[model samples]
Target: MPRKFKVTVNNVDYDVDVLEIGAGSPQAMPSYTPIAAQIAPISSVPAAAMVAAAPSAKTGPAGAGDQCAQMGGVVVNIPVKQGHSVNEGDVVVELEAMKMKVPVIADRSGQVARILVAVGDGVENGQALLTIA
Candidate 1:
């Protein structure tokens, strides 16, 4: 047997049907199907609207020597400050994701021209962390 109930989520009301198991013999059990699969497809919906917009590429403020984050995480430490000298492969920023520390390395050897992110800041992939001149 299915019980109908009204549920509210984010101020939106939804009617749901829930079936209780073990109320009858195993042979009387009904096959389960997801609600989404049962809904009819809407051909009127535009394909572009169904797809999400991609994030835009970011560049350093100086327009060169930008060191971007490879993954999304919280900044745990900044090893280099603005005007500090750095070499290729040097760790410029450290991020913590999934309880693991990840180091952001410099791709070019130059002085740190700017630090775009600070310690305790959250960063996304491709976001500029610092720039080297």
Candidate 2:
């Protein structure tokens, strides 16, 4: 609450809290300090759910079970659903992020035929994770 500087010359107006203004002298405009460490310490939650918990949502179809959203994460673990019968690279589903997990394999063999996203949802990056007919 201590730092006032608002000077205007000509019509006459001056209010200085004094902080040494001399180099060229002309300091009078300072009032906006809420720099609580450059903002980022309130954290009651809600920063858009911490950016939607990072890269989450948008998967449903690429090969076996169609598992396509190649990069987004959160499903964490699906194992295999639909008609179940993978082969290519198997792994089916298992994505996470920050904590890192991401699997989503099986790019060839078939049978799963349709599962999309479950266990916890939230996928996106490339979306379409399931459908190996």
Candidate 3:
């Protein structure tokens, strides 16, 4: 018996076939089939919309945005807010991902100009968390 699975990696789709054999004869050539593309993360937040003159666009450094989380997660808390002073390594925002709480820290000492994410809001990688200026 054989099973076929379609997998996607880095937006590239690939089809794979797996065969099971017992104490029988040898195997021959395997088969492959390509499938359609899977859902993309880009659809969550369009790059064009991020670059536009939106409220979230003013979140980080140089009026661009704050240092975003390296991974996507739900914002659990925002310890820092506008007009609040923070030092490097200070816990700014906490994110819950994979059932673990991840703390987002400040990289430099500065006054928080804006807090981009609110508690319970879903955030994406490279998305603004807060602005320090």
Candidate 4:
């Protein structure tokens, strides 16, 4: 049997056709997505968002408001605070996910803005771990 599925890529939707050994008509054709593009990570951070901003918009950087959260355990320690500066790979969330402590690193270098979770609080996957400004 053949199946049809819809996929969204780069803000564009696509209707794809499949052939199950003997499916589809001879006139069927595969379409290429014009807007969808492949992304490669060559470095720890992308080069575009790191560029300096104009004097008006106060967005210090893209990673400035990013955070790392605990996976499955309680938030044990929080070494950094609001206004504190950090570099990439810095330990931001010290959590015990599976009978072991894990260190969630800072996704990028920036100043801390907000601490969303608290100590001794149990956290789930993708929870707000920290905030950078």
By lDDT, the best candidate is 1
- Candidate 4's displacement at residue 17, Å, is 70
Clashes (candidate 2): 23
Off by over 4 Å in 4: 1-64
Instruction: Provide TM-scores for the models.
Output: 0.63, 0.28, 0.53, 0.49
Off by over 4 Å in 1: 1-24, 27-31, 34-47, 50-52, 56-62
Q: How many backbone clashes does candidate 1 have?
A: 0
Best by TM-score: 1
Per-residue alpha-carbon lDDT of candidate 4 for residues 14-118, written as tens digits (9 for 90 to 100) = 998775653476546666655535544547555675564322322233243667453557888898987899998888779986678988898789898888778
TM-score of 2: 0.28
Which candidate, 1 or 4, has the higher TM-score? 1
In candidate 2, position 81 carries an lDDT of 76
Q: What is each predicted model's overall lDDT from 0 to 1?
A: 0.86, 0.73, 0.76, 0.72
Model 3 off-target regions past 4 Å?
A: 1-65
| Local accuracy of candidate 2 as per-residue lDDT tens digits, 33-103 | 77775676647678988887775434323433345756766887888878878889878888898898978
- Candidate 2: misplaced stretches above 4 Å? 1-36, 47-56, 59-64, 72-86, 90-104, 111-123
True-structure RMSD, every candidate: 7.5, 12.7, 11.8, 13.2
Tens-digit lDDT track of model 1 for 61-105:
435688888898999999898999999999999999999999998
For candidate 3, lDDT tens digit of each residue in 1-133?
Answer: 7899999999999999987666554544444454434445666878887678444422333344365776788999887768988888899899999999999888888898877678999987667788888
